[model samples]
Target: MRPSVCLLASAMSSAKGMSPGPMALLPPIHLYRRLLRAHRKHLPPEMRLLGDEYVKAEFRAHRNVENPVHMIGFLTEWQLYAQKIEGDAWVGERLDPGKVEKMSDEQLAQLYELMKAIQKRGTEEGQDGS
Candidate 1:
């Protein structure tokens, strides 16, 4: 419906004898979000930590920028943070990448399981609350 309306509008304008160049469909913000969703799967293994919610938050934070390209810097930061599974929290608390790497494979696997369980519980609680 929307597309038909747009086409009708454009056709009317053309009937008035004006040139119809290409029209920009989605705005910068919408395009930004679509690009993020499209490429999330392409992110490296560790960097996938910053999931949908995290990306949405970052998108909100970058909303002030007129050009969406400015969001590249914010996205880079998010990627780096996500990749640091063993890094310090935003402040100075020690995050030992070496320590995480040195852990036994079983320990690492268990930790991954724990993270999944915690995420699932959190999601359930949020749904229940609402």
Candidate 2:
């Protein structure tokens, strides 16, 4: 079994709660490490660079979060992303419309910036491709 899957199973099997799931099972650090490992194993160099930095920044930003709802949402999204990366299913995928609709203004702005950055990188690579 994959490390993340094992972690999830361990978390669930040990749970005594009413609704134990991914968010309630895996700890933040374990998920963070799993993501980093996935990126290292699956991503190209350029993507790994960007993904690693983004993951570090995000984890650092959320280090002190006290709200369970927010923390659950944050961890759940990252966990899904890790699974996607591990499964080699992330390339060329479009953002989900439902997820976009649920985003706050700040999150939307961040997504816009990420889009612009990706476009800029593609343009630069195209120009250099000769």
Candidate 3:
């Protein structure tokens, strides 16, 4: 068996006699790692940076949490976020007029930064074509 699968099986067996916990449901560290990987693979540049930073901060803050309920809730939320990004349900990079109108000032600023980056790249490409 693969090492990870072996490890998971071991963890599951060990937790069999205990009350159900986040670890019993799924390994928290593994879930966190997968969430980060999903963010990197699926999010746009600016959103990726923001998402990664937020995930890192949340994981770090909750590193020592022992409450299974809180851990499960946290993991569930992050898992859904990762799935949405991977499924292309998140439209962070798309500047839909309705979405743009609802964005907060910080989100608008991030969008502006992304626009600037795109414009810079286009200008460079045009200059190269000359």
Among these predictions, the greatest lDDT belongs to 2
Tens-place lDDT per residue, model 2, 4-116, is: 54454456547676574544445777888999999999998878888898899888887766666676677778888999999999988999999999999998998898788
lDDT of 1: 0.50
Best by TM-score: 2
State each candidate's clash count. Answer: 0, 0, 0
**Model 2's lDDT to the true fold?**
0.79
By descending TM-score, how would the candidates be arranged?
2, 3, 1
Over all chains combined, what TM-score does candidate 2 have?
0.82
* Residue pairs in collision within model 1: none
Write the residue-wise lDDT of candidate 3 on 1-130 in tens digits.
1345435434653765677644333455676788788878876665566667767877777776666555655666666666777798876554468867977898688668767766776687689999
State each model's CA lDDT, in order.
0.50, 0.79, 0.65
Question: Residue 63, candidate 3: how far off, in angstroms?
Answer: 0.8
- Residue 62 displacement (Å), model 3: 0.7
